[model samples]
Target: MLNFLKKNAALIWAKKHVQKAEEFKKNAEKNQDELLLSLVDTAKKTLFGRTYDFENIQSVKDFQGKVPVADYEDLKPYVEKVKRGQRDILWIETPEYFAKTSGTTSGSKYIPISKEGMPFQVKGAQSALFHYIAKKNNADFVGGKMIFLQGSPELEEVFGVKTGRLSGIVAHHIPNYLQKNRLPSWETNMIEDWETKVDKIVEETERENMTLISGIPPWLIMYFEKLIEKNGKKIKQIFPNLQLIVTGGVNYEPYRDKMEELLGGKVDIVQTFPASEGFFAFQDDYTKEGLLLLTNHGIFYEFIPLEQYGKPDAQRLTLKDVELNKDYALILTTNSGLWAYSIGDVVRFIDKNPHRILVSGRTKHFTSAFGEHVIAFEVEEAIKSTVEKFPAQITEFHLAPEVNPEEGLPYHEWFIEFEKEPENLDLFKNELDDQLRKRNTYYDDLISGNILQKLHITRLQKNAFQEYAKAQGKLGGQNKIPRLANDRKIADLLKVYKK
Candidate 1:
């Protein structure tokens, strides 16, 4: 009976999702203006629409002129009103659910999630799986159990609106039949305490026929470690059928070596770009070029060049106008309440035909103290290159700028927590510095002029970042270590655990 359900469901879902992808491609090619106009027409009755004069908007240019690009801070006051039972403020109706996200700049944030936008979140994951299975030509992927390592499904009410982590809300909406084939049952997932939940997951999935696993990289590593310890075998030894691993929320390049090492073999990996605002993009192709932007998923997108990100009057480009291979700050007007919202993520387009993008980094996550602007994507690539050059495996890392009156010159400090320590620490540091120099011209110029000293490396104790996150009460479930900080706040915090 289970086999019958799995096979039939996979067939139905794959066919439906392929059609959706094709429609997305067609829309990307031509119907972007139509989609934008339709969204405005649908939202004109809402309070935000009225305030922004969505009724009079005739073209993309008109919409852009009327609505100001905004961050979460700008939307918070209206969200607060929605939380207090206000109706039709941003969307057609008051949101029945809110996704609570750990705001790095602000305090915690409650993003409105309407009924209309819920399917897009589920559809994003489904489309990703559909593309992967179709690419691998393996419909049997549905025959075995899959594990989604996510937050608890249990929810709380905020002024009559259901509220919880975004993943938790998605989990709660999973179809009953699919839930049967998912591991670490609802009870275990609701355990709140991450350490305890991990132990329970190990015990429950130890002997199950697990085929797929999905989560952020760090927590997934912890689970794999626990599995190895408990069963006295690598992941493949226990779950030989395991074929695919899905991850996001951080760069997977740094964790690839350790992950493959623990799994005991090469495995297919899929990267996704999902956030509290909306499900934006996913790895649709096998190649490592970039993620396919979902152009028609009840979300409209705008891009601002990174250079003009915070300017008083920055130019916003629609899909038709955006060029290939330029870093842009992503803005979204979703089916949910968020309008002209700057999602804070930076992306660079790699392909124009299908509109594929590589998530470069965050808008606030860059260093320019010495007039040498370095973004997080460059830092991540440098780390990956340096690790490959050496034999080190980095578990977690943070970068910060160091400037002291006593010291002769300022330099960037890297605090790295290594799973497998490098043989020659000095050589590793030099290689990393060289990789950064090759990647960023501005940084290289600074080094050549001797305006900036050589980069410094500080090896951190194992689990230093985990401990720090725990101390800050953000240990798990979408809370991540910021890869780059403008100042020494994160550096000073992690210095106590330096080796």
Candidate 2:
């Protein structure tokens, strides 16, 4: 009955509003004010109203110069207030549940998750079906079992309570059939859960023919590596009917070559963009260039200039005035009752018609080590291109800056697990240097001077990263080994070899 209601409601809503969006797009310029008024008025009732200062929100939207930029740190007080079940700065009622953790950026940012909020995740996640129906033109997903590598189901109490993050909540709320059968029945539930426990996963996969796989990119890569190691050209021997692989949480390009090599071909892959704050968007079409924004349901969208976050003179943009192709930091006003909350992600509109967007990078994750701003994608590209120059294959790799207080230069130390050691380590390093120089000019400038940006390559014994992750309590059953660490201390935590 619940599923029926969900399907019918989504179908009815989509039919009405999708057409409304199309009609609005047809004469958006003419009906700009009217459309804006209608959207905000509806949003006021649906999202804002009693929780927030609706008049102030309208005033800010109307003023249009800039709004205050607030990170998780800034919102901590209010979020804590919500966690304690108090009337927060926004929400009139206490949130039903609180989202546990943020991603790799900050440790854990607890956010309010209402019953209203969970539906967005459900609807957004279900859009995968819509993607198949609309784009791939396939209706049924009655394939083999799906492996969703995420965080653990059991919540670790910080003080004395059980408040696991979104993953736990998601696990709790999954459809009964899905919950009963689809997941890997190990100790760890998600990628974070599986990180520490690969042997059990390998054993599980050996038994079952996994057709659909889902996880963060790094964990998926790690899982595939384990599969290859155990089976040895036996993936086809075991999972002959393996069809689709869905992944998110990290960038895909860096591991593309490695993943392809492991899979023996391109695994039919789907990338996802999900956050605890909101089910912001998902890849809708086959081209997979950008994700389609979930325009309605529970959230109100707003964009503020990336350059102006926290600055005095920053301008905020509404649905009515977002420009195309420009990078803007995201601020979400949601039914969970977060008003103008900065999710700390940066996205750019790739298309204006259906509001397609590309997630450029996180504002916090970018590295300016030695003043060379290298994003996750940029570093991934550099690593991929660097390895392509070598005849020997790279199994796993991690990058980080070797910061020395006594020394002047900041250099990148690469911890690489290889199938076969390269003949000339110097030559291999030179090739990587050349690739970085060609691909990232900022890196080149930093290295070309008196400061020698040395690439230290540590050849790992077979299954070294896997071993290391296991040793650090980060392997097999849901924990992930860091692919790129910004500093030496963090790198030391994950590195298999020191010198």
Candidate 3:
């Protein structure tokens, strides 16, 4: 009865977020304007502010002129000073925690999270849940057990502040209301080894009333696979109350087919865009295809067109300047003290009124070995479109360029693990290649001009991706395999598991 009341009260408060969101979304420009001024007012006393002359900054143009668009490398010097217990270097307040994450070129990076900023992360997640509740007008799942497959909650001190993965850090901030409904005991959550952790999770949740699950799609796949392997039945059969799957960090569309297969049908999925730096957006409307930008959050946004990305005088555009369907690199200036920070993710605006966007790909994660810049969005779409015609069940896939093959010309190597292979593998390959060619004209030219052969498909054994991730000490949690790379580092590792 207490649980029932908690659900009712939580739903009532969550609806308030929907109402608040409606207010700002109507005037995203005004929200961003006020948000920027608030951020600037708080950060104007820092060392960075003095250097950039933040006090003199009056308009968006003035702010952009004062602060250059920066990458992690550009901001590393300031970050280093903060690690040595320096305050007011970036923001007046010291960071309470540093979220550690793997970097693309750099080995690892530590992102600061301030006391003032941390609550917004929690609220953003809550707001996402609330938005879903508002959309569906259903909170039936809240009374049942919920699980969020994440990294260990254990943290280490970095200087004076705690340091851990983004997910782990967020774990400590889960609201009191959710503490009762959430599952997988704290001791079970503390297991460092993912295999052992999943085993314990399977045991703990096997017979429980699991109504909702949250995690990256890949890790959830592992958990679902383990449960099905043990229980000898599908997920829905085991937990009939399951209603919603909250997923984020990576795109969920790529794994939709297999995830549905495991669940024995379709289920509601709410996609969110949360990172160590900030919670940027969440899927607000079920009918829409993209995430709604969080303008009222403490972070201010800037969009740099991918085409104009690397130029010396690249234009840093505001929300007012962005157009629909054009690729742009996302930048953030947060209360945590990152100034014009490049988060490395590419996005495309699908709606402008309320500012809804699709995460296209990463800035550095692209296949351009032969000057054909094939992005994650294009490749994933190509595969998704081809799968419609081929009717194959793909478990996982990765793409890398075989720049120097033994005999033939260069080509893209697609390592695919299929649960159910298409009846005609040759036809599937032909159709996929055709689809990609239609999408990326440069790739089409490369193939047509004989600069490269048709992409090669190396059929991988079941559990191939899982095995590869296991070998790298990144089997579960927020870790994700890059969809495409310019080199063979991942491709060579995956070769051993080819069917």
Which candidate ranks first by lDDT, i.e. highest?
3
Give the number of the best model, judged by TM-score: 3
Off by over 4 Å in 1: 1-5, 8-12
The global C-alpha lDDT for each of the candidates, from Candidate 1 onward, is 0.87, 0.63, 0.89
TM-score quality measure for candidate 1: 0.96
What is the RMSD, in Å, between candidate 3 and the native fold over all Cα?
A: 1.4
Q: List the residue pairs that clash in candidate 1.
A: none
TM-score of 2: 0.77
Instruction: Per model, state how many residue pairs clash.
Output: 0, 27, 0
Task: Report the error of model 1 at residue 469, Å.
Answer: 1.4
Off by over 4 Å in 3: none
Q: Candidate 3 on 18-48: residue-level lDDT in tens?
A: 8977888899987787778778878888888
TM-score-based ranking: 3, 1, 2
Per-residue error at 325 for model 2, in Å?
Answer: 6.2
Better by lDDT, candidate 3 or 1: 3
Colliding pairs, model 3 = none
Candidate 1 accuracy as lDDT: 0.87
Q: Candidate 3, overall lDDT? A: 0.89
